[model samples]
Target: MKYAILTADEPFISLAELKSLLNNENNIYYFSGIAVFSGDYKNIARRSSNIKAIGEVLAISNDPKDINEVIRGKCFTIKPNVILRSDKDRFNALYSTATKGVIFSKKCETLDLIFTDGIIIAGLREEERDSKSLLLHAKKPYSQSGTMDAYTSRLMVNLANPKKTVFDPFVGVGSILIESAWIGYTCLGADIDINMLEKTKYNLKYFGYTCDLLQSNIATNCIKKTDAIVTDPPYGKSVNAKTIKIEELYEKLFSISSEILSKNGRLVFATDAKYDWRDKIKEYNLSIIGIHFIYLHKSLSRAIYVVQKR
Candidate 1:
């Protein structure tokens, strides 16, 4: 079906994540903050919170009479498709008459009107944006260094789209795992710090999420293969101590990752792009499919890499 999507401020990252989740590029079109595509985007409402809404296009406005013509019909549904009004005076004038027999409410419904550059598309609501309640719960119970925003974690995990199980090799306080479970994926969290693991358990139970958590450093543990991996490792430009270690740290790291990550399995992880990750992934035959640069501030920026084992 043809659908229009409203995206967030940092649309590039969210759009990339959405495209990866859709696993399609054809029939997908981009606008200022909207994406028009023909495919199964129904699952999108369930997957990511970044997408504001998805709907079928009913009507578009280019001619002056479009709004007047729609108003003339005078038949609106009980669960009416809202007017995603772009012009204030025009909407107020329409509102004065449109609600003459139509019901209106403040709550969110499934379908509504979308106005893109004076074009009006009427869409049946597929999914309202996922709630941030779970994210809020996660933040309240845990405090740590370099905490990824709940939304970013959700977007990253959605890109992975792990089925059966999702693993976080460097699951610090299990923030990513919480987002995974929110999207209905069984999660396993591993961290070298036992204290962090214990904290993860605390946070998980606080949110009533049952997760398999262990304290195993990636450098030492022989990890059993997992369906997918999404992690944000706490590290500097490089973990090397003397003049930056020569691929030793990442070689060992990706070696273990290759052992644990299943064939064709998806992985999403974050890192400073200046590291030796490319060489390390080359050794393990892992290929990066999507990479987005996230700007944190003037001095610091990071890259999120989406990977698949070849």
Candidate 2:
């Protein structure tokens, strides 16, 4: 079956990556992409066509029902195979495709419509309920630098063992921590900002996640060692001046990470700067496992690193 996995903003790259991730399936062919809120739809359409060569074009709106008309028309000439909806629009889209039973929904906030033999698959929200709500609320008022969406967190939990404890040293608003807890992992979160710590506490409680929150900086605090460390650290742009210098911040992060991370433990983190993090990994003697590039906005491409303690 030709499956389309919708990705976050500027999804072309993510779609390609998802295709590679799903490379085991010989029948899957990533045909096209549907973009939302992007002003350059013409350019995206042109790019999509250039990439897929013979794919259809569809403009996605806030309403899922609107897509039905386009899909029914087979405007792309490719039959409706399966629709992978983003987490943000999953609920409404799911309602729209309630009758379809073969749908496969990836835990992401982007939509990917797949075309198998012209049959749409059914989708169910897989991430824990409590975690999704908490992360949504946090992104509203105060923005974190390199935060993961609820679907990404769900994917992370699915990729890793949920039974293992996950720690977030720079747990801004506790999005990752709460999500980890919701997925049945013992979570530990710490932050330097008192306000963020307080918010993290409230959000965790709101999500009914019985996790630990520490008010110490990742640079100076003594946090418990864990099986995994999943964090979105402060980038040069979003952090305070004292913590903005890339070299200094990374130095501190390495120090703290080295101290608390257990032997062979996993550390998954993201950053948006142009720094050479590979050097830091080598300097710290950490084992590089995998790296993913996620385009957050038009200009920002976050580098997500999955490293293991040596």
Winner by TM-score: 1
TM-score of 1: 0.80
Steric clash pairs (candidate 1)? 58-122, 59-120, 110-125, 111-125
Give residue 305's error in model 1 in angstroms: 0.4
What tens digits encode model 1's per-residue C-alpha lDDT throughout 177-244? 88888778888888877988888898888888888987886777645778888888765743436643
Candidate 2 lDDT tens digits, 1-310? 1223344343554443333233232444443342112121122221121122122235333444454544442322122333333332445454445323223334322233443222233221111123334445455444454556665554443333323688877888777776677656888888877899887887777656678887876567566567777777877567678636766876777666666678877677778746568877767868776676755687677776767778
Worst 10 residues of 1 by lDDT: 76-85
TM-score of each: 0.80, 0.57
TM-score of 2: 0.57
Q: What ranges in model 1 sit over 4 Å off?
A: 2-4, 64-112, 117-119, 237-247
The worst-scoring run of ten residues by lDDT in candidate 2 lies at 41-50
lDDT of 1 at 19: 78
